[model samples]
Each structure stands twice: as structure tokens, then as C-alpha cells.
Target chain A: MLSIQVIADVWDRHLITMRTIEHLHMFSIALILSIIIGVSVGVFIYMKPKTANPVLNFLNIVETIPDLALIVLLLPILKLGAGPTIAACVLYSILPIARNTYTGLKSVDEQYTYVAQAIGLSPREALMKVRIPMSLPLIAGGIRIALVFCMGVVTLGGLVAAGGLGTVLQNGIQLYQKDAILVAGLWTGLLAVLLDGFAGMIEKKLHERYGTW
Target chain B: MQTERLFDRIESIQFKGITKKYGEGFAVKELDLEIIGGELLILIGPSGSGKTTTLRMINRMIEQDEGSVTINGIDTKDADPVRLRRNIGYVIQNIGLFPHMTIRENIGLVPKIEKQNKKDIEERVKTLLDFVSLPPEMFMNRYPKQLSGGQQQRVGLARAMAMDPPLFLMDEPFGALDPILRKQLQKEFLKIKNEINRTIVFVTHDIEEALVLGDRIAIMDQGELVQVGPPEELIFNPANELVADIVDNQRKFKHMDTLKVKDLMSPFEDKYVLEAKMEACDAVDEMTDRDLETAFVFEGDELLGQVEIVDLMKCRDRGEKLSELAKPIKTFQPMDSVAFALSEMKNSGEYLAIVMNSKHPVGILVSDEVLLKLI
Candidate 1:
């Protein structure tokens, strides 16, 4: 029987802690950049609905490419490391955020926009004040999905020596260390659950504030 | 009224040889019409007959492909579309109160956009809420989703009037409501318009609504202005077959002008008067003795209001004076038609209409008497 001490020892390792921090840093940076790019693209497409299908299709195609293949494809330009791994994760994250944003914006009641125009709000003002605020719950939902998704894919960072829980699992498997593998996998799962729960809380709060729920 | 002077500035909207086309066909073709300021001019037609197109062109929502639409001789094209729209009130059938905004915020939007002071905006919102008959305290904090359809449309109207714009464009504003609510709103709107005196271009396909509400009815067919005139003129002297056909459907409203309030109302008498300081018990006793349901409560010759026998009986203090128990009277000039008086009586839920000559109450038109005349 594996002792609790064994699991505690692995959890206390400085190297694992460092890897966890690095994993969070990469995930957060990529997620932030993805959100900015994704939401911007979404707003652009919403303004001109004719471009929606083409743009979403292009992103859909990117999503279809395997995660490792996309990382490797970026390797030629960004080279192997945290850079290419984060870039690939960001690319993967964009599809959900962009798609959800586009759908949410499109779903906003057009009557409000018509009133916005009739009342003389410039189109830009209407989008910012009315459309975006009204679509917040759906937009936040998209962001939450993207965040959880990025957390899972970020584990793959260890494959390129980018340093995350994946590296611990990889070393454990290579050396046939059962306790090490179990601890690493368990922590990664816990981290994902924690981040997803946090995102869910945020989404709930946004919906409540906007009274959209 | 403050709104009376607001109408004097902009006399009318003139459309001169205006035309708008979509693809191959004209949406509105060579429309030449004049809408008098301070009156509700209803542009009514069948669906796709260009009533909406004409209304939109006034606000520059849909730019005219040719000719000009002028408000008080200043062409709409000369003004910035956004600025011009800000100065015009608009209401649509959907009653688009922003779901995200509270009723207070929705009603105060245009004033906020105009950069009015916060105190002024708040005051204006309260005033508009009262004007629309929605109590501020109960409705101001509630969101749009919290309101019923009729309540939402009332908020929509209050929002439109936030800036007190001289020109209003209502595109089937009450078309989506149920019949009962629609009639109630129509009456409320007529009352509001009478006080505000703003020029209004209202579009509707409902012939009854057009005939009942419009100061002048403009009938359109196939993007052409078939005729424009007062409801009575259009009924008595329709320009063509189409006009006659439309008016023929609403023949009852046509006979309204034949009898004036003077002909219908009974002359004022000392028996109908009650001193303001008279005790509630005494007032009730007097009404009971005369078998009267209502009597005008007066502070010597000046009409304070009217007191109902039911209201006087309900007074907690038998010693309370009639002045304390009386409700404000709804007065109309003797020149007003019996149709107008009956409608007013129906709307106010009052059985008596105080017919005034100048400011003094000359007569009282009992609801039963008017009904008898109509029968």
C-alpha cells in the first residue's frame, strides 16, 4: 500500500512547485492574449455579419488541427520552448472565445439596437453600452470554456521541456515511479477543477449583475 | 402649457416630390404632403404601402433617394442625422426598453445623452413617469423584464418624451398590445398629446385607431399619398374610391361631429352646486335628497372640482368638508363635440363632463344623456 507520506513528499517537492507556477504563468498569459484577440475578432464579425461564416470557418479549421501538430507547426517559426507551446494554446483557445462571442452578440435582441439607433446613439456607442453589456453572460461563458480548455492543454507544455505537471508525469512514467505519476496527475486534475470553478463563479456573478440569467 | 410654445417654433413638416426606391420599385413615390405641427397626423395604409418608409424618411432613418423632407422649412438633409434624431422622439411597436436598464435609466436615457445635469435627469425621469401614469417609486427601480407588456410600452413612451422633442414618430407604437391595453394606451396617448402639443407622425394600419386618434388622416396606397385631411373631411368628402372604402369601414366615428357638447349638455343650475366648506354628511344628504350621483364642489362661483355621493359617503369624518372629499373635475369647452365628451368621460371613468365656457363651468353633460343622444 502506498503511504500518504509518499504523496506528501512528491507534493512538497520544490521542482514540482516551480513547474506548477510556470504552468499557471503560461496559461494565464496565453488566455489573456486569446481573449483580447478572440473578442476583437468576434466584435468585428458581429459588426459585419457577412464575414461571420468565413472567419468562424477559418478558426474552426485551426481547431481541427491536432494540438501537438499545431505546436510543432509553430516550432518552425517560434522554435520549441514555452513560446511555441503558449502560442499553440492561444490559437486553440481562440476558437471557443470567438465563436461564443459571435453567437452571443448575434443573439442580442435587435429591438434594443433599433431603439439605440432611433435614440441617436452612434453605432459604436450602441455596441459598447448596449450590445456588449447585454451579451456579457454569453461572452463570459465563452471565456470560461476557453480558460478550462487552456488549463488542460497547458499540461502538454512539459513535452517541449516548457515545465509543468506534465514534466513530473513524464519523468514518473519514464522511471516507472508510480507514486510520482499519481501525485502529478491528481494535482493537475485538482488545478483544472479549481480554475474552472473560479471561472464559473465569475460567470454567475456577471449574469446576476446583468440580470440576463 | 409649456409644451404649447414648443410647437409654435416648428410649424409643420413638408414633403416635396419625395421618392425612395429599393432595387427596381419605389418604396415611397413622389410624396407631397404637409403635416401640421402640434397635431397627430396618422399615415395609414396596407402593409408595404410605404407608410413606414415615409415616417422613417422624416427622421432620416431611411434616406430619401430623391427630393426633400423639410421640418419648418429646414431640410432634414441639412441637419446631421444623429443630431436631428436626438431632437425627435421615436416609439415602435416592440416597446424596446433596454432589458439591461432599470425603468429609471430607460426613461432618463435621452436626457442623459443630452448631457443634462444629473439632478435634472432624475427630476425629468420622475416627471415623465408621473406623466405616463406610472408611479416613480414603484417602477423606477424595476428592470424591463420585471414589467408587463403594457407597462414596458408606457416606459418606452416615457423614454421617448425624456427630451421633450417637438417632433414624434411612432411606428405602430401600440400595435403589439392586446386590444384592451391598446385602447387604454391610445386614450392615454391622446391625453398626453393634448398637454404636450408636439407634432406627431403616427403610422398604423388599424382604421379605427387612425380615425379615433388622428387630427388628420393621411391615406397611402402603393407608395402614393392618396389623400390627407381631417377625419370628418375624409369621411364626408373622400378624394377617391380608396379613401371612401377606408372611411366606409369606420362610419360610426363619422357622425360624432354632428352634435356639439352644447347640444348634449344640460345647463348649469344652483342645485348642482355644493359649497366647498359644506360638511361631507350635509353634501351627501343634499345629493341624496336630489337623487344626484355627483355635484360640482365650488368655492363660490369658481369651480373647485366635483364631489361624488359615493366618495362623500366614504369619508371617515362626517365633519370633513366637501373640498376635502372632492376630486379634480375634467372640464371641456362647449365647442367640443359630444363624441369628444363621451370619449373623455369613458377615459376618465367619470359620469359627468363639466362643459366650460372660457374658465367657468357652463353645464354638465351626464354620461346617460350622451348615451341617449347616441342611441
Candidate 2:
């Protein structure tokens, strides 16, 4: 059985509460920025469908690059802080959201657009009113997937001196403290799961409201 | 918000020398037609027959490659396509009511877009729901998925009518319903069409539907209109084999319910008439000359009665008048069903009946003679 005193000792020594807040703070910024950019890029590709393949291919290549290397690459310009960390988090999270948004927008039933046009909706109006609303369920799903990616990158942020749960994790590994690493890693994973659960609930709600299938 | 009046009542829709090409084949070729206002004209044919293509050209859903479409003497080319569509109501096979919208919202969409007042829109939606036989209180907030297909179609019609357009274009609007539901919708639609009384161009492949609903039916084959006329004319005198085939199919579809007395009635010939003041001997001579057993005795416009040859002969020997031997005959109106007329003829023990229009005998309905006309 796990002792309560061992958990408390690890918590006080690593300042677990403060680290969790920092992790969430970086995670929130990255997720919000990723959502805005991803959705815009998705809309842009949808408008000019010819650009879809090339833009998605380019994003696909970025997604394959190792997340740690992506952060290391940004260190030259964004130099040793949360800036490189957050940039890396946004970079990694965009593909799922952008790809999902584009696919969702493009895949709306032809019947909808045809009816929208027949009923005298302007092309732009139809996109905003019919296409986007119908796309909400899929979009929410994409954002949920992006949330997981953001959490992973933000946890990696502490390796570059960006304060988060990762800082406690790095300290435990460097100092060879077994309890610190276990507690910090487990806490980070638990926080990501809780955030994923919250996003899942939102996704389910949107699916019920706007899902076509 | 002040709503602006864009299009006036449509007096005529003329498709003059219109042609539309798709790849190597023609979807519609040099079609010419005139649709009168307040009449429901049906365009019907087989799968590739250009009926839908022709209907779409009116609102520029698919613009023609050559010639022009004009409404009320104004060329449709001069109008903005979107504005023209907004002014014309449209319905399709699938009853494409927005799935995410409430019934009231779907019905009010176009009017709201036109900048109509909110409270007025709600009231109008309620009235429109009632117009389509849906209770507004029970259905206003329901999404389309919650309703049955028939109910959704009614909401589709209500949405189209929201703009109060002068013309409506329907492309197989009720094609998605089951037979019973389709028949129900057709009856409801005819009632609604009667109430709204707007110009409509409808497209369908069902011949029975065309015959039942159209004031004038236009049949197309391989991108050209084979015939355009009232249903009776098309059945009696088809322009080509395709049209004859369609008419033949219509007979099969309706199971002869569409056949009426007007289709088989003939003009009441003067040779079969005996003047009311004529001598019985002259009446016998006239009836013998025509090789007939009976002649109608008429004094100008008044139908006195039918004079049988045997009765006329008896009167002739006594030197009596043809009017004195006249006997009453059964009469029927031209619009009655052929089956009803046949049953009447059987009940009255008469093979022939006078086809009348209220006070005047317009034609003659003969059982064997009309059956021979079908050949």
C-alpha cells in the first residue's frame, strides 16, 4: 500500500501545486493559439481547395518531426524560455485540428449546400451558417485531439527551463530522486487525462447537438 | 427592417430556343415553352429527358448556353441570379430543410434574410405551419430529424412559401415519399397550390402524377419536348411514339382512373337531329337516310327529346308531327368519368347518352363508338 506521508513529502518538496498550475498555464495558451491558427488555415484551404493537398502535406511533414527537436530548433530565435516551449506546443497541435477542420468543412452533405444555395443563401453565408455549424462535432473532436498534443509538449517545456511540472520531473531525474520523478510524472499524466476528459465531454455535447451522422 | 418588393406577379414564363450542353451530349436542346401564370405546368419524361434541366433554367440554377428565358416579358439574363432565386421559391426531392434549425427557424430563414421584422416573422411562421396543416405549437421547436419524411416535406413547402414568391420551381418535390404518403402530399399540395395560386414549373418522371396534377403537361425525350398540351390532348393525340408510350404508361399507372367522358365524347351531329315541327314521314326519311334508329328533336337550342324510328313510323301513318312521338333520353355532362357514364348507360339500358353542359347538349357519348375511337 502507498503511504499518505510519502505522497505529502513528495508534494511539499517538489511544490506540486505550483508546478501543475504552470503546466496548465502553458497548456492553455498553446491550445488556444493552436485552435485559432488551425481553424483559420482550415478555412483558407477550404476556400481554395486546390491548396488543400500541398498545405496538408506540409503540415504532415511538420507533424513527423520529433517534438523535442522542434523545440530545440526554435531555441535560436525564441531563446531558452516558455516562448520556444509554447511555439513547439502550437506547432505540434495544429495538424489534427487543421486537418479535421478542413475535412469536416469539405465533407458536409451536398444536399445542405445545394439547399442553402437554392434558398438564396450567398456562398459566404452558406459557409458560415450551414457548413460551419454542421462541422462543429468534428471540429470539437479535432480540438480534443489537439489538447492531448498540447499537454505532451507543455510537459516537455521544463527541460528548457520553462517552469512547469516538467521542471520537477527534470530535477528528480538529474538528482536521482525516485519518488520525485514518479510523483511528478504521474501528476503530469493525471492532469493531461483530466483535461482530455473535459474536452471529451464538450465533444460529446457538440456531437449530440450538431452531428449529421 | 423594411422589406423591399423585388419581383412582381409573373404573367408568363417563356423558354425560347433554349439549349444546354453537358460534355458531348445535350441536356436540353432548343426547347420552347410558355408557362401561363397561376397554372401548374408539369414537365415529365424518362431519366435523361431534360425536364429537370428545363425547370432549372427558369431561375438560372443551370443557365442555358444559348437563347433566353423570359418572365413577364423581362429577360432572366438581365437579373442577378441570386436575387432572381430569392424571388422564386424552390423545392427539391430530398426536402432539404436545414437539419440544425428548428421548424420555425427553417420556415422563417429567407424572410429574415430579407430583413423582415422578428415578431412578424414568428406570426408568419405560425400561419405558414397552419397553412401546411402542421400545428405550430407542437412543431415550432422541433428539428427536421424528429419529424417523419411526410412532415418534413410539409415544412419544406412552408419554407419555400416564406418568401411569398410569384413563381415556384419544384424538382421531384414529393419523390421521396412512399406511395400512400405521396398521394396524401399530392392532395395536400393541390389544395395549397389552389390557396397560394402562383405560377409553378414542376418536374417529375411519374406519368400518373403528371396527369393528376398538371393543368398542362410537357413531355420530353432525349433533350427535346415531344408534346406540350392539356392532359386530355396528350392522351388523345401524342406527338410521337415517346409521348404515346408515356400516355400508354399513364393509363397503366392510373389504372384508367384518369380516363374521362370528355376524352371520348363526340360532337352532337346535325344529321342526328330532327326539327321539332317536322312531319313524322320526313323524320323517318331522315332517320332511314342516316341508317339510325333514333334522332334528337330540337327546336333551335331546345332539346325536345329523342324520336325512335318505330314511334315515328306509327305517327307517320297517322300524319302526326315528329315532336308528338318524341321520348325522353338519359343525359350526362362531358366531365364525368367514362366508367361512370358506362355504368349509367348500363343502368338506363341505353348504349348512347347525350353529353350536356348544364342546359345544352354539347356532344354524344356512345359506348361502342367511343371504344372504337381508342384504337
Candidate 3:
């Protein structure tokens, strides 16, 4: 087993604590932007169903691009540091959130909408009152998925001088320090798992409230 | 905000040459129907016969291709569809109570949208629950899924009645119920209809339910109106073979099941009635003259059981009074179906049943009379 002092020494040498804060900061920004844009796109496609296929296909293509390749492509436009990393994370995350929202909105039992109309709910009211509430569990599920993707991408931010846990791992590889690589890698994974676990709890809460069906 | 027009009442709805088509086939074709205000008119037909389509047109759920649906002589096309719908109470087979909302929240949605006072809405919701015979205290806070199917349906009715719309459009609202529950709800619905003065357009495929609930029924076939009349007219003077067959085929076989003991009961003949103090010979003479196997013994309008002619003859030698020889008889409520009375008679080994209404004997049903009515 690795000694506690050795692990603490490695943690201090690369400033892993500051790197984690930077990783989380980038992750939050990217995730928030992804949620806003993804949900808007989902609602747009739902309202105009004809565009759903094209838009989702385009997002799928963005998702297929390797993470580093996406960052490299964005660097010319968004520059290095946290900007390209955040942009790449958002680009990767939008598909899952948008697709889930679209599916959720579409899958609401058709009867609820008919009832809404019969009860004199305008089209907007029907969407706001019935459709949105019914779709929440699914949207929350998508956000959970997006959360995992953001955590992974934000860790990779350090490779491009974005200052996250990924930078410590890069330093360990380049300098051939086994302690730095092992400790930073484990910590990054633990952070991602913790955040994902938090998101899962939120999803469970939303499911309880809105997935009574 | 523009003030939304409020329709205080709708007295009549007239469909003039209204048509709706899906692809090549017509859902409803050139249908003309006049619904008088405040009557429960049942639109009945086999499935796909356009009864539902016609009902939806009144509220503009399914818009007609041609012609106007005029409510109280105002063309529905001229009114905003949303504003028009708020004035119509609607119910469907699925009940359509929102799953996420509690019973109170579901019922109060429309009132909130219309900006009604909160206290008034709560009061109205309470009265509406009472109208459907559901006590608010127990059910008001429950969610839709928490209630049984029957309870959910009652909440559905409470929601529709919350609008207090002058016209109600119901499409097979009780079609999902089991037979026993359906009959009970039908009776309860009739009581509710009596309590409210409003027009109703009910759609159903079940002919028996239509006959039971309709003030007048309109039959549809292949997207065409076959006939429209009161249940008596359709049963007695059918305009065509299809109409005749509708009344004959469906109504006759299930007549015993649909008919109540009250419909077949006859008032006990005066000659066959005996006083409790009358001598056995006098009771025998009254029953014998009318050929009545049993005679009711009454002491000043109170039924004191019944005396059989055989028992009367046997007790004559002892000079026993009618009350002394009288045997207790089974009593059935008037609402009990004739079929129920027959099955009950078979089980109990008795053929005579006193039809009681509120503990007061109104009439008697004999096996022979029940058989005659069935035939």
C-alpha cells in the first residue's frame, strides 16, 4: 500500500487542491450553459418535430469527435486555458440533455394534453403546466448523464494549461513520477463519482415527484 | 390584458351540415343535429359511427370541414376556441384527471385560470364534490393515482362540474366501469342531472346505457344520423328497419336486466286486499274471487304480511283472523332489477315479492307477472 505521507507529498507537490477547484469551476460553467442551450433546442425541436432528426444527428456527430480533438478544434476560436475546455464539454453534453428532454416532452400521455385543451388551457399553458412537469424526471435523468460527461471533460482541461487535475496527471507522465499519476488519477475519478452520485440523488428526488405515472 | 369573453349560459346547439373527414373516409358527414338546452341527449352508435366526432365538434375539439355549429344561435366559429371551451364541461372514458395534481388542485385549475376568488373556488369545489356524492374532507387532499378508479372518476366529474358550464360534453365517461358500478353510477348521474339545469351531449356505443340515461337518443351509422327520438318513440315507432332493429335487438334481450321491479309491479288489487281483523273465510273469498294465490293483510295501510289462499282455507275451520294466518313475505326495493328479483326468487323458493319504497309497500310482483313482462 502507498504510504499516507507519500500520497500527501504528491498531492502537495502539484497543488491538486487548487486543480480540483479549477476543474469544478469549469465543470459548473459548462454544465449550466449545456443545460440552457440543450433544453432550448429540445423544446424547439419538440414544437417543430420535423427538425428533431437533423438537429440530433448533428449533435451526435459532435459527440463522436474525440475529446482532445474537439478542444484542439475549439482552441482557434475560444483560445486555450478554461475557455476551449468549457466549450468542448458543452458541445459534448448538449446531445444527451436535448435528446432526453425531447423524448420526455413527446412521451407524455396524449390524453393529458387533450384534457388540458378541453379544460381551456391555451397551448402555452398546456406546455407549461402539463408537459413540462411530466417531462422533469426525464430531463433530470439527462442532466445526470451530462454531469458525468462534464466531469470527465473538465478533468481533461488541465492538459491544455486549463489548470485542473488533468495537469497533475500530465506532469506525472512527462516527469515519470508514478506517485503523481496514481494519486491525481484516483482523486479525479473520486470527484467525478461523487458529483455523479449527487446528480443521481437529484434524479431520484425528481422521479419521486413527477414519475408517479 | 384583453378581457376574455365569458359565456354565462348556452341554451341550445345546432349543427348545420357539419362535416369532418380523416383522409378519404369521413368521420362525420354533413351531420345536422339540434340539441335542446337542459336535456341529456345521448349520441349512440357502434364504434367508428361518428358519435364522438359529432360531440367533439360542439366544443370544436374536432373542427368540421363545412358548416357551422351554432350555440344558442351564435356561430361557434366566430368565438375564440379557448374562450368557447371554458364554457363547456368535458369528460372522457379515461377520466383525464391529471396524475401529478391532487384532487383539489385538479378541480381548482380552471377556476384559478379564470382568476376566481380563492375562497369562492374552495367553496365551489366543496359543493361540486357533494354534487357527485363524494365527501370533500376525505378525498380533497388525495392525488389521482391514490384514489380507486371509481373515486378518480368521481373526481373527474367534480372537475368538470367546477366549470359549471351550461353545456356538458361527455364521451363514454363511464364506459370503463364494471356492469354493477355502471348501473350505480348511471342512477347517481341521473340524480345529479336532475339537480343541475344544463344541456348534455353524451356519447356511448352501449345501447342499453343510452336508453337508460338519455332524455332523447340520436343514433348514428356510417357517419350518418339514423334516427333521433325519445327512448319510447325509438322503441315504439321506429323510422326504419335499422332503427327498429336497434330498439328490438338490443333492448328486448336485456330488457329484464335493464328494467327494474318497479316497472313491472302492479298495484295490489282492492278486491284481493284483506283487513288484518277479517275472518279467514272473508280473506279466502277476497283471494279466491280475484284468483290471487296470495293476499296482502293490511292494518290501516301498514303491510301485515300476506295470507295464502291454501292457508286461509286451512284456518277457516278454526275461524282464525287473516293476520293470524298471514305469513311474512320478502320485500324488494323498486330499484331492484326484474332479473335480480327472479334470481332472488329462485334462491329463496318464493315467487311473490312486495315492492317497497322507503319501507312503505307500493306494489306486489308475482312470478306470473314477471314472466309475462319478460316474454
The model with the greatest TM-score is 3
Off by over 4 Å in 2: B1-3, B250-375
Which predicted model would earn the best lDDT? 2
Residues A2-60 of candidate 1: C-alpha lDDT, one tens digit per residue: 58888778777637788889889999998999999989998999889999999999999
lDDT of each: 0.81, 0.83, 0.82
lDDT of 2 by residue, A1-213 (tens): 236888799999899899888888988999999999999999999999999999999999999999999999999999998999999888887888889999999889977988888878878878988899999988888899999988888888988989999999999999999888888888888888898999999998888888844
Clashing pairs in 1: none
Off by over 4 Å in 3: A6-14, A174-176, B1-5, B115-120, B250-375
DockQ of all candidates, in order? 0.37, 0.38, 0.47
The digit string of per-residue lDDT tens for model 1 on B1-375 reads 111222334688999999999899989999999888788999998888899999999988899999999998889998877778878889988647887889998888766766778999999999988887666876799888776666778888888888778888999998987553465578668889899988899999887678778989999998999999887788779998888888766344445567688876678877778899999877765765554556788887788888765456566355898787778878888888777778777777776668889977788776532233344
Fnat values, one per model, are: 0.60, 0.60, 0.65
lDDT measured at residue B12 in model 3 versus the true structure, 0 to 100: 80
- Prediction 1: B-chain TM-score: 0.68
Candidate 2 chain A, poorest ten consecutive residues by summed lDDT: A1-10
lDDT of 2 by residue, B1-375 (tens): 434545679889999999999999999999999999989999999899899889988888788999999998889999877788888899888748888789998899878887888999999999998888776876899888777676778888888888888999999998986553465478668879998899989998877678768999999988998889988798878887788888765353244456677776677767677888988877766665564556788888888878766456555457777667777777888788887777767667665678889987888776532222342
Top model number, DockQ: 3
Better of 1 and 2 by lDDT: 2
Q: Report chain B TM per candidate.
A: 0.68, 0.68, 0.69
Per-candidate TM-score against the hidden true structure = 0.77, 0.78, 0.78
